[model samples]
Target chain A: MIPLLKRVAVILAAASFAGALVVAMLDLPAPTVHLPAAVEANMAASGVAHPVTAVLLNFRGYDTLLEVGVLLLALLGVLAVTGVRAAPRAVAPAEPAKRMLARLLAPLMMLVAVYLLWAGAIQPGGAFQAGAVLAAAAVLLHLTGILPGWGAPGPRLRVSLAAGFLIFLAVAGALLARGALLAYPPAQAGMLILLIEAGLMVSLGLILAGLFLLLSRDSGDEA
Target chain B: MSASLAFDLLLAAALLWSAWRALATPDIFRAVVLFIVFGLLLTLAWARLAAPDIALAEAAIGAGLTGALLLDAVGALGSRKDGAP
Candidate 1:
């Protein structure tokens, strides 16, 4: 009877907590935010394209570069902490039914990831979302034991991770030489944005996949 | 004030809650998993906030990379013992 009461109490508490979360998020009170109107107006007056991305990789390039460095340091730290161990093979026998399902669905997942990366130009989806999804595909391959060989800090992974920063810097240097740092051709805004975004997607995908496989070299765990 | 701001607030709340729960968990593996979920949640929020650059960084570097690192850390800390809880 006591155990039964405890179980009921626990369930009620969980339900109440979930209810609170829903209320907090779905029925948030109207917010009163005040900001100077001229801030955005001033941005439009200057006429620089993609002030956000500019800030991300150019004006704030130093910060982004530093952040990437930090990520590298963390990866290195993980490798150091966990002496490299080949990921263990799954102990369980694969059910033929599940294996067939996995085989059929895998290609579709990869296609969806590619489509997300390509369609990011004009939608809510973008390089980051696409890259994360792509990394998930790589993880599936790894889990299913169908992955081709992976080496630590492989050439492809190295190139993908470094390319984004290098390309951004190169573009910035060209603009600097032109006497306006990180400037884009006003007429070719769409083309330029598309280019940068594509590069970002590839770099992001590589960085994510590399981090996973590299760390897995020692830990070999994935979700 | 706007629909976007409201959305950002909700995202922020979710991130906070995930982080809190991850920290509160006693089991190490589950905590690590929840933390990874927190990272992914932040990526979605960043996108809605019109920070695609941040969203990219968060999903790839923050969520994916950081999650890998911490999971490896837990694995290094050693799995629970045969007799001990």
Candidate 2:
């Protein structure tokens, strides 16, 4: 009787909360400050044809920079908690069908990643999406035994992992020296954004993939 | 209502139902699968709102990566419980 009462109470609370949210949505007033028009007006000066890219990498660059830093920090936290040194374990070969799928898909995914990065300047894709696709490819390969679980990152691996954040920081610093943070010269903004995205794509891919690879190593140990 | 509005309403209902089931389900695997369904529904919602960028990100990172991670965790938990290789 008590359990049923408790469930009824919870459901009633949830229903009321959802109803309130719907009411709030229906009552929303028109915004006085229209951001899209403002963004459109400045698009030419923002150095990217895509409004979303312009805002993300140019106008609100600090947010993106900090986001990258946060991701790197999260990876560091995971490494510290797990202990950086991973014992190497032999992985039994995956079934032939799985192996073939991984082999065929990984390269194609890489191509898609590059395309997404390039398309960000004009379209809906960007470094985050591209990096995720790259990470997904690595995870698929690891699962299929084509790639091994990570141990302690080598010097080269460490550099690759930090390269994107460092490159982004360097650009921000250079722009800061000019006057303000991430204030790219209009003429050079396109090249600079592309360079940062390229670096970010590689680093973000490694860091995201590393999160899985590092954790999976412990599971592999027990198996 | 217009056909698009009707479709949007149906989508929203599915999203809410899936979210509720994902939380209330007894089986962990079924909950995770429902969560993935919720993510896909969210991706569709984003696309319907004409925010293709967010939709793409939701599909890849929110659904794909997160689903894989959750499934992996479930596998690890199951193995530990069974004490089987």
- Best-matching candidate per TM-score: 2
Off by over 4 Å in 1: A1-106, A154-157, A220-223, B1-18, B33-76, B80-85
What TM-score does chain A of each model score against the native chain A? 0.59, 0.93
The segments of candidate 2 whose C-alpha lies over 4 angstroms from its true place after superposition are A1-10, B82-85
Q: Across residues B1-85, which tens digit of lDDT does each residue of candidate 2 receive?
A: 5999999999999998999999989888999999999999999999999999999889989998889888888877766555355
Q: Which residue pairs show collisions in model 1?
A: none
Worst 10 residues of 2 chain A by lDDT: A84-93
Over all chains combined, what TM-score does candidate 2 have?
A: 0.93
lDDT of 2 at B43: 99
Docking outcome class, model 2: medium
**Cα lDDT, all candidates:** 0.63, 0.91
Interface RMSD of each: 5.9, 1.4
Q: What is candidate 1's lDDT per residue for A14-123, written digit by digit as tens?
A: 88999999899999876676333433443442223445544444345456545555655665675566444443343233466766666776688667767765555444
lDDT of 1 by residue, B1-85 (tens): 6997888888898998999999889787899999999999988987776777577658766777567668766885565453455
